[model samples]
Target: MIGFFVITLGPMLYSLYLSFTDFSMLAAPEWVGFDNYIKLFTNDPKYLDAVRVTLVYVLVSVPLQLAFALAVAMVLNRGLRGLSLYRSVYYLPSLIGASVAVAVLWRQMFGSNGLINQILDWFGIEGMSWIGNPETALGTLVILNVWTFGSPMVIFLAALRQVPQYLYEAAAVDGISRWGSFRHITLPMLSPIVLFNLILQMIGAFQAFTPAFVVSGGTGGPVNSTLFYTLYLYQRGFTGFQMGYASAMAWILFVVIALVTAVNFWFSKYWVHYDD
Candidate 1:
């Protein structure tokens, strides 16, 4: 606990204070109360763009990821042969999804001369560079984010396993179809896990950096379509040399994530069912 406070809490509080200053990692931090935060809302359109991009990413990616993960989990739960091998294969993407190599590979894969375009060419379809097009650049990042469904799938599998078989047995006796049983019994029982995965993925989506960074070449290029919140924060802090401004952005993101998570927890009372 003491170590956590010192290592984690200490930097957090210090950074919070820094958010109100005008530090450029040069000579000294000048005290400028709320200037950075005020500028973010009033003067900076790019910051607002980042906010919009981040919200779209979180809203779009998390649901698709959860849905895909749940579907995969349900299929795998049906006692497939060679389960361990298949499980590892599915889980591999999530493990390396954020790696620099994978991001670079995705960038290449979505380029005009890459695998996707090559496949399209085989079908006599003209291919455009996905990562180079403003419309499709962000979409590629979303696809990359969705591809790592293994983490939530594993959690869903575990939650599904914990569900009492007696409920399903009883439901079957009462002529409940598979869909009906899943909708009523399985869904209600797995609600807690769903809530858990939602919160985690939402936070992660807001903090997504690698795909945009690598795919967009760290500039959120093609008209800033992929300017994720974290990437912008990083650019401001490290690239633009505005540590204090970046700190302000970080705190704002922290607040946004906290409020979103709080809202989820609050709404969970309506949807999330606990067996207790």
Candidate 2:
């Protein structure tokens, strides 16, 4: 327990402490009070832009990702032919989805001369630079988020199976349509699972870095459309050597996520059903 505290809590506490000071990698940290936070809120347009971009990314990606996952999970739960093979195929993306290799592949696929534009050309549409244009670059990241839905799909599958078959039978006896049964019976029962997925995906989206870093060529580019908060924090800390400011940014992110999670849990009380 002591070792665990030293390894995990120690670094976190140190970073919290560092958040209040001015530190570059070269020199000892000097106490700066709330100056870093004040500067960030007032003077840093880049930080504000990063925050806005990150919120947009999280709001768009998390729900879409969960929706896609739930849809696929429903299909897979129907006992399809070659179930094991299909499951393996679906799960493969989640395993390597965050890798730099996957990001590069995504970039190639979305580039002007890539497969997507070639497909567009087949339909008599002009090829456009999807990742190069600011309008479309963020959409590409959203697609990437949706593409990695396999993990949540698997979780939803497990939750779906735990739902009682008797409940469906009861709904059938009540003359409920399939959609009606799903809405009232399935959805309420699965609300807890949905909430779980929502929180997890929201946090993942908030902290997303690799896709933006690799796909944007490490500039968060095409006018910072892909400039995620974590990526910006990395640039400030490692690239610019503003460790103190980066630490402050990180703590702000932590607080934001905590508040969001708390709000979610508060709302869940009204909707998330527990049979017990």
Task: Count the clashes in each prediction.
Answer: 0, 0
TM-score of each: 0.98, 0.98
Where in model 2 is the C-alpha error above 4 Å? Answer: none
Per-residue accuracy of model 2 over 5-96 as CA lDDT, tens digit each: 99988988899999999999799999999999999999999998999999999999889999999999889889899977887899888898
Q: Which window of ten consecutive residues has the lowest lDDT sum in model 1?
A: 21-30
lDDT of 1 by residue, 179-267 (tens): 99999998999999999999999988889898899899899988989999999999999988899999999999999999999999999
